[model samples]
Target: MVKVLLILLVIYSFSYGKIITGNWSDPVTPIMADYVKRLIHKAETENAEAVILTIDTPGGLDTAMRDVIKTFMGTDIPVIVYVYPPGARAASAGAIITISADIAAMAPSTNIGSASPVQMGGRDIEETMKKKVINDMVAFVKGIAKDKGRNEEVIVKMVTESLNLTAEEAQKQKVIDVIAENINDLINKVDGKKIEKNGKEIVLNLKDREIKKVEKSLKEKILTILTNPTVAYLLLMIGFYGIFFELYNPGSLIPGILGTISLLLALYSLNIISINWLGLLLILAGILFFILEVVTPTFGALAISGVIAILFGSIILIDPDSPYGDIPLQIIIPVVLFSALFFISIAYLGLKAQRRKTPTGSEGMIGMIGKAETDIDPEGKVFVSGELWNAYSDEPIKKGEKVKVISMEGLQLKVERVKDGSKI
Candidate 1:
């Protein structure tokens, strides 16, 4: 009985070695970096055999990519970067991360490479800066390749020449360890692979291991939404519109509240994503020009310039090479046109309002025709603006006669007898 119990306990203890698995299907942002860090920490705490991250990205921010690579390389547990799904391609930063993994892998029909760095908007940097960036990226990839025992020459070519390769081609070049059909296949292929960690050999025994799938936490999901570039851009535009409307019609609680919230959120998003200072400045300047147009009535000159500034600003707001990519022109054009129309209409209405005569106050009394309540020789009371006021005129005026208010005086109105007086 004692021996049977001992044997059962041993079998139960060794039956399932756990492995952590998750998907990274979006651009690498600060939020994503924090997520990966949390996953790594979770895997470490759970004593998992390995972490299997399935990737499908067009690449992302340079700083974020480096942060992810550091997390992978710094961990004791073996980290596998699998370019999964048939149609997936690990380009740019994704390619570099793949080559940096303890076990780089891919699904059938997948491809990797194209690690060249570019500025925001997918444009190359200036020549001198381009060479520096290219050389730096080349060295970075080469070092990662060397450390992971991958083909350094080919990996360097991926940066310098933007070389890309299919799964079979990558395998032929010794760039990946396995071509997997799925997660299960990946596990089986690398089940017995040995990795060096902290000068010690750590063997993966991932066969039939319990797969612990990681899901984003609620906080992570919210942060993900907030960090999205498109969401950020929209928030910024909405913030501006809200604040502008609030200024145009003061005491509008809704616009002020929404504008403050949206502006804060947008600013937070900007902190996480790389942005162009010039683009942000241009956008602000555009809004200022719109306000000036309303205040000064520039005959649409400043309004036109505002439109142009905003258009260009929207085009270049996000970094050209950012993983999220530039804001689509389809969205930009409609937004720009609509915003221009909105502000222009407001400006026109403001100008019109200014031209309108006052309905109350001293200015309202000017040019008004009223009946003289008392006979006057340069001093008398006159009924004006529905009230009898102390009034005086240059010439004598009779009672029950019409008078025209020329101007206002302290507690009085300066008036003149109406020429060809009609009915009061």
Candidate 2:
């Protein structure tokens, strides 16, 4: 019984010092949220001393940021958020995350702060709205700072006024606990440090421990790609052009099918992100107007309105606070103008083709003078434009009477006697 007890103690010791490292660099998507939850679960199951979250992000969705904060608040594992790699930062939502951690640390040259919340769209909010948002964010940050034993006043300033600080200053002000040059040093400094988590005492034992990396899954990769502004923009254009190509050519299956797929993907992305619904509707309306102009040739009026709508819609399609905000105005303006020109050009060509006279076969031979090779009352053969055509005439004519082709009816040509006696 003594030997068995000793063995159990040894096993518990071996399981008590696990370190789980999580690297988060982007806005927290649902998949990212799940991944973090799984990591937390793994750490708890393995009896981890602490969970280290390596953060390097500009910001992300407010809801996702809140989700991460909720996870941290509920977890038993002591979460240490470390902003590493010298030049990294914890801006926007990252600031909230860093302040919420059990132990915050940063590498030399790294910075953190700037937690002001703005409207998702680029438009500025009213003064009252701004005050409300700032006050709420202040309360949130103050709570996290209080829980982490950091300076709540400084944290409030960081959120409301976008204050920035270097790692050294952060450590000096107790905003962070330590400023390590690298991960190795961080581990050494944190090892054997007693931390209370959920009212239980645990000591870190991270000396010489192996580091494991958790990667995003394939589905997450696809989501990241779709969320990209450039890719989403391209998809929208491809969808519009695909449908347009199908409409112009009627029976081409490839363009139509591809366009439908692209448009659906674009729509799916827009739906997932926090997009201005009005902007989306305006873009759809623009496309419809352009298509109508193509069908009915609206002398640039529809084209002009369509261009304006498309420009406004594209500019406002995705939330400005989102990653999509990186899309340049230069790109947007040129693409909108070019797209409008392309539509107009196609419409002009179609209208021109419709108004032009026929240039092929018997239908093209109308108004050409021809000689009657055989003559009768209303049915005979005539040579017109160097081709023999079945002919009909209201006037009586001799065998070689000169006749002018007036019109074509199926395979027959209707003709009248030429003013001159010459056979044509």
Candidate 3:
């Protein structure tokens, strides 16, 4: 595709910035990191003038952000990060990635900052730990700013105090290199810039060049949705519910299959979210309790405990600060209530089925009454429920006399003559 685009670039010879763009509209994840890494690699391989990554995100995992920054820094081609369109932000890890790029740019109405390292649920770090975290981040951002030749003074405050700056303020403070109105403005301004990469300085010479976009891979696309907090959590619950339904109604086929699929998807997503393993274990245990409730009819005791366990597990399962935010109470509450109700209903059904009389099995005829088709002193042939059975009577019975089925051993039924004409 790049080759084809390059051919067009040569053929058309339209004079402008030869830009290869990557959109970072999603929260940073391992998948996003890989996507950007490949983007840069492709840009370098194709010898493009520069690579521009337009970032628009609230925040995401720190590790994923760092990985993306590492990729941008290692590339030989000039990498540019732009916060574009109206009302976009380069918050948290986005700010870090922006500063790490060779050239940082932002459009009007955009903002950047808020690099504080909070937990998944937006809980701040405790006293001693928070100080340490802030200091470490200060030192880290300071280093990144120094290496990239951007301002570190404001960045330090950004991490410690969650300072946010508009595009104009960022440019004025040297937090970013350019403040453009849009992508076209960015392309025009960066046309004559020179940057040193891998000990070699390259002139951008971007004017009159074609722009190409880097598309995401299939794996990246699927993983992107899995990183969403709401989606991942839903998948997790659906997975458990599916499997639970299957277990309650064994051999139903559909429920189990759906549950397996949903669960696997949830697991894959949770892996990216970096959820607490213990929380996940607790959730699984709670689900087991629910299953036990159905199997043993524990009078709702197990189901109640299961609900508690699931609620707690879900609350702490995901860190509030994770790209996948803490599982919302709305989701957890409904899921728990639904799960409990389902388990209780299923238990009731199981007990009811147990109490129901057998309609057509060996036990069905235990107390059925039939007339003796043939009789002997102690043996006869009896007709019961439309079937003839060999019979043994404890007392003598005459042919055509009604007999009560007392028991059965193999094909023979133990019976006796009806005493008071009791109806079957």
Which prediction has the highest lDDT against the true structure? 1
Q: Tens digit of lDDT per residue, candidate 2, span 86-122?
A: 8999988888888788778999999998878865533
Candidate 3 has its poorest 10 consecutive residues by lDDT at: 318-327
Task: Please give, for residues 1-424, the per-residue lDDT of candidate 3 as tens digits.
Answer: 9999999998766434357998878887777787787787677667778898998998888888888988877878899899987789999989988988888999899999999998765787798988897888899899999887888899988998899999999999999999888877898998789877778887877766778998775445656886787887898898798889878997554565456546655775777334465467658867987898898886776787678668766765763225453577879899999999998999999999999878776788889988888864788799998999999987988788888888889888999889975433
TM per prediction:
0.62, 0.59, 0.61
lDDT (0-100) at residue 51 of candidate 2?
84
Q: Is candidate 1 or candidate 3 better by lDDT?
A: 1
CA lDDT of 94 in candidate 3? Answer: 90
State which candidate, 2 or 3, has the greater lDDT. Answer: 3
User: Model 1 shows how many backbone clashes?
Assistant: 6
Instruction: Name the candidate that leads on TM-score.
Output: 1
Assess candidate 2 and give its TM-score to the true structure. Answer: 0.59
Error of 3 at 294 (Å): 29
Cα displacement (angstroms), candidate 1, residue 242, comes to 1.2
Candidate 3 C-alpha error for residue 417, in Å: 41
**Shift of residue 147 alpha carbon in model 1, Å:** 0.9
Q: How close is each model in CA RMSD to the real structure?
A: 11.6, 12.2, 11.0
